[model samples]
Target: MQITTNPEGRTILVGKAIFTPDEVNQGFEQVYKDNVSRVKIPGFRPGKAPFKIFASHVGIESMKEDFTEIAARQALKEMLSGKTIRVVGNPTFEVDSFDGPLNLTIKVSFIPDYELSDPSKITIAVPKFDVTDADLNKAIDNIRGRYASMAPVDRKAKKGDFVYFKWSVITDGRASDRKKEELVEIGMEDFVKDFDKNLVGVKSGDIKIVMAEISSGQEPVEIEINIGEIKERILPNLDDDFAKTLHVENVEALKDIVKNELLEQAKDAKEEYIESMIAKALLEKTNIELPENLIESSVDDEIEKLARDLSKKNITLEMYLEKRGINEEQLRAELTPKATNQAKLDVILDDYSKENSIEASEEEVDQEIEAISNAMKDARRPALNENDEQVRKNLARIIKRRKTVGYLMGKVQLTEK
Candidate 1:
């Protein structure tokens, strides 16, 4: 067998496997034998039918098709064995003139070449915040608001007020007919971009129209928003009673708890920002030629995982294809870039782990297992035994990855927020 690759541009790779008559004949004999074992003739029982007789009965063309398919599958596997080829989807196979040399063409899609920079040199400014008395008070109010009850207000909506409104979003000049009613609090950064800004000074009887940009097809889309009604937030009074409701002794104790929570949140956010910065810097600093085969394989795996997840939700892959308005080829094309990025991140993280000598000890592994067991117990699930070697080994890997991330964050300069 002879193999050659033809680049079809746009990341599509065509691998042609040309088989000689000897190879084809061998495959044909195997196919005939395999079929003859299960098939029966009028006067002959299974496995007793001669190849010549079976070929005469089944027709040469039909037999050739079956044999060729099997041969192609085997040949393709052999051809791809040692190559780092990332196949975006299932290969499209074409047998060009089987009567000749049994030439087969297989098309594989994948992401083309791209380079990522090192993380150390990439500079990013992280927002820093100092925990102050006002900040602590604000955090306590936020906590209270989580458990706050809303009452029907007779006034207009204002800044720092929660508004429940019905609205429709126009995406790419096409207005959505579905009515989206969400409870949005003004001044909350968690709300979608420009949402809170549009809600300010709006009344219950008024309908406000606002425009915002949202992600659409690889670009930002200007969306027109139509607001229905707005209602002001009715926060619970922060007092001794509120503290008692939160299981705290008094307002002072509640404030302390809120402050500590805020500090922890700030620390986590700072660490996350630093990690992101480091990843960016490292990618910029290092230049590695990615294995194309790996990216394609990862994309295929991602697609299969997506299909399985959708299946669990009682949706078929066809349903997803229809919803996305894309064919299998288009879907694969879209996933190629995503898969490449994920592969790059994985490679970088793995390299970083090895370079830093990151490892989890037996005690750490045991602790992780215990933690998981406790969590499962709390969630009313079966507890995993600490002595289970497989479970411990798996937990050890997880703990090691977590510790590596923590260590990397600590290595970076973090401005506390």
Candidate 2:
């Protein structure tokens, strides 16, 4: 095998590999052995047919195709042997010829060579976040709201009230599937075209007509609702009785628990903020060239994730972009920079982890795999095997990168505001 590299930037290596017949002929025998029992040739039983006769039955061109494919990886490996470069993502290959001397066009993308800035010399100041009264109140309200009671009122329906009504859509002259006594929180439930908002100021025993787009690409239809009653949430006071309801000693003990939880949340937020600051500062002074295929793959992943998230809300990414007065091109343009930054961050963290001798142990990987198994037990999915080397390496890479981020965050200098 002979290899020649294209003279270009180090981000990608475009090269040509040519394998001689002697190197490629080693593949046809194995292909024949593997497929001998899988194919049916007339006048001969499976695995009893002569090699030449079976090859002829399967067509020489098809056999050659399989043989060439089987040899391409070996060709690539032979080409990259003794090279100092590390591959970043999956490499691509194109078969140029299947003749006596097989020609292949290979594209190998490697991680870009970059250096990390000195952590001690870095200057990034982030605000010291503190748990405030409002934060504590919000957290406690979250706890109280979960246990709040509802009471009926004779007044008009308000934003936070639960309104029970009978509703049906009128199409042509008929009402279909009329639902009665359906409950919906005024500001919480998402109804068609602010149907809940139109319920504001509604009194009992009143009939309300709302225009809603019930069906896609159809004209608005009139939805008639017969009001029943309005109920409001009454939050319990933070007294000793309320504390007892939550199995706590008293309100003071509850506040202490809440405060401690809030402090933990605030600490996490502060570290994240400082990490973001560090990323920005380092990126400004860092110069790195990522592989084109890696960037494109990352961008595709971002768009796919966005589309998937929107799908959960019964919306398409295209519809979302159209609602925002944008197109796919505009969406991709907006996502490219974020994807680029993320790709750069991965390369940066991997390099830093290596430089600082940071790595994930086998025990750590087993713990993660065990956690994954526990989480997926209910889904009935196959559990990941801890002994799988590839899975272990991938999990190790993730853990190492996170550790690298935490290390950098620890070095960040924060000034209290």
Cα RMSD for candidates in order: 7.7, 6.0
Encode model 2's per-residue lDDT on 187-306: one tens digit a residue: 775655456787889987898777877654467888788899889999888799999998999999999999999999888887778788888877777788888778888899899999
lDDT of 2: 0.83
How well is each residue in 1-417 modelled by candidate 1, as lDDT tens digits?
888877787567777888888988887788788898777677888888888898888888988899778867876787578867555556678888788568888877654544444334345568775588888877777787788676666676777676776666766766678867678778884556655787777767565556544432234344444444555556788889988988899999888877888889888887777767776666666664454567777789889989999999999989889876799889889889778766776666765677788888998887777888899999999998888888888887777777776766655554433
Scored against the true structure, residue 93 in model 2 reaches a CA lDDT of 84
Global CA lDDT computed for model 1: 0.73
Instruction: Tell me how far the alpha carbon of residue 184 in candidate 2 is from the true structure, in angstroms, after superposition.
Output: 2.6
Model 1 clash number: 19
Q: Which stretches of candidate 2 lie over 4 Å from their true place?
A: 1-3, 7-10, 17-83, 98-101, 117-128, 168-181, 192-196, 208-225, 276-286, 296-341, 363-395
| Structural RMSD, model 1 | 7.7
What TM-score would each prediction reach against the true structure?
Answer: 0.61, 0.69
Query: Relative to the unseen true structure, what is the Cα RMSD of model 2?
Result: 6.0
Poorly placed runs, candidate 1 (over 4 Å): 4-15, 73-92, 106-126, 146-157, 160-242, 282-340, 350-373, 376-417
Cα deviation of 346, candidate 2, in Å: 2.1
